[model samples]
Target: MAAVLEPLPQPDPPGAKTSASTDASHASGSGLKPIKRLISDSRIERIVPESNAATHLQYCSQFARDFIRADYNFCAAKVTVARGGKIRALDAAFRESGEWLGKALTWIEQHPTRSFPLEHEVIELKITHPLAGRLVRCLTQYDRIFVRSMEVLLAGKIQSHERETLLLNAGKRLKHIVQVCIPDNDAYLTDGTRKTK
Candidate 1:
């Protein structure tokens, strides 16, 4: 089975310092077409197994890693695995401590028919300089992957609009997350309302 932390080509040197502008440049060249084309695996059955959730979860995590390894050649670095159980120790790169995390929370809330306790899981692939911006820009893309994976896992059938809706929802969610990360003075407000962030 593949692990979720699949490696990709390094956009910048390992441990290289980064700035927002550099990240934007890398992100701009990330070739949205390629990343978008590498849609979620149609073969994933579920995040957790019906009989043995832990064993199955581990198996799935490893499988996700393998899938990433096979799919993204320019990934530049090993992916990171952060499960709901591990949320308290999130990386400090994030400006806000608990923002951009509703994905996991929502997943945990909506999980159904599981015999064992399973929290949300995030398999993050670090985007090197320049590419980091691309990651942030395209962060919402994963919403489709998450939703589709869950649909297939529990319903045993993929919803036609699940991907689109997920992507759209991701955009909304991500904007909120970014807003939260930005400083109050630097934040963008529409019509005196603090957007969803």
Candidate 2:
């Protein structure tokens, strides 16, 4: 005879630390308002300003490098996936005096023919953390394209040329990503009106 599978019973909730009446009194005493956590889905959110995108790319790259050095799986994966494959390892970024922006800026200024190598280190690292691999893959294409586009835009800007085209292209790219990643009802107005879905 074959045995049938059975579901396990749910456990009872832990006893309350405070009574409902006490909660209300506590809330009233100091005008304590319940805080709703702002759960933003970055995956869907469009890059606002080009500057914002740059900031994110730079910081995410820096974090990835530090995380790799720390040997922390969680942080490393978050950083690597967040960047996609557009960036090099964090160790490379901190070559001189352990400075991130300094090294990056210097590299940019010097305009090295080969700034950084694109190694699939993250993919191997992802073996220990599959989610990190996914994140890395997502960010790589976007980051690379965004960075290249930004460079062209900056060159135009520095040359005192009209940046309308550059701005438009960046906006378009950001919009495309945002549309894919963000749901319609994510944003809201100050007056508590939810954005149209």
Candidate 3:
């Protein structure tokens, strides 16, 4: 079980160490296990599963990474950014998308069943194909158009709209994942169909 740490009281002086029992010290009063070391394997597994979550994570993360890199590179080049700046932008894009991918994987794990609109376990093979197309649409933030704040803030008045216009190949990869890969909610492959990941 995850420890619910209570907030610590304010110290007499800023950054001063309290001689009395703090919330952190009180929570681990038993001394049986350190509070920082108390995180369980299940909790870690919930973030990134060792066995089952890999398949979905692989496809979805790849698509996001590719999409971000492509979009950033295009914008950078169009704006006459230096090659080094473009490279740095690509790195930033991947890092941001990686954070999103981790959250997306956790959501996929919890939802479990994505074969239909009603959100139940799917038994048939055909249903999964169409469902991935829809599920990935949500997973990839399809409706939310991300506009970089720095780009807008730096563009001043003249280049604002031109700087933000960009395209991505994520749709092609998404189609391939849904139509061909058919990722299962089960981390393991139970049926005869082999998982690509």
Candidate 4:
């Protein structure tokens, strides 16, 4: 039996060289005061915003594109019953990008469209990374549908003026919520969170 693992170690990449203390004290140098925040009401987001969905969409597309470029597989799968690992990877990405990702997913779930093409002109033919090609191949038809839905949502291209399809806007709306939840900090980490002590 052969198995592959893709480990997501949280906010920090595995090879990052940095020192941080999980201590709250390190976060606040004796000020002992909660920083006033504009959003003050939600979870943190990995992408920063210029206070608009357009910006969020830009980041989202790049997030997908860059993610496709990264080499993060842990092992090759010899046998599998389903594509749980692939689904998990996508879920982790959504959570990291913003709360909106989950919202978008919900909309896609309800608005199931089997029209996802097995071959599309938009899927870039040139993938420079060798590993990404195999990764792409492992994607199930359902997985492809889900990802394509996200790509469309993040692209913000409103083609159908149908009200039912407007649910795609949920991603944009959640992105707004993310904008408010960002913490006030002197230093911003790569993922846009304040450094912990």
lDDT of 2 by residue, 1-197 (tens): 10111223245478835567875664333232322211222321322211211111221232233323332233332333333221222222222212322333343344323233232212122222333333333344333433443464455423323333433443343233323222232343333233455
Q: Which candidate number maximizes TM-score? A: 1
Residue-wise C-alpha lDDT for candidate 3, range 49-99, written one tens digit per residue: 112211121112333434322331222122122133333333344344445
RMSD of each: 17.4, 19.5, 20.9, 20.8
- Tens-digit lDDT track of model 4 for 33-124: 22222121121122222221110111123222332223111111111111334333333433443344444455555653444332221122
Q: Count the backbone clashes (under 3 Å) in each candidate.
A: 16, 8, 1, 3
Error of 2 at 107 (Å): 25
lDDT of each: 0.35, 0.31, 0.30, 0.31
Question: Where in model 3 is the C-alpha error above 4 Å?
Answer: 1-82, 117-197
Pairs that clash in candidate 4: 4-75, 5-75, 21-197
Alpha-carbon runs more than 4 Å astray in model 2: 1-72, 75-124, 157-197
TM accuracy, model 1: 0.25
Ranking by TM-score: 1, 4, 2, 3
* Steric clash pairs (candidate 2): 44-181, 44-182, 65-90, 81-135, 81-136, 84-139, 84-140, 85-140
TM-score of each prediction: 0.25, 0.22, 0.21, 0.23
Residue 36 in model 2: lDDT:
21
Q: Which stretches in model 1 have alpha-carbon errors above 4 Å? A: 1-156, 181-197
What local lDDT score does residue 121 receive in model 1, on the 0 to 100 scale?
32
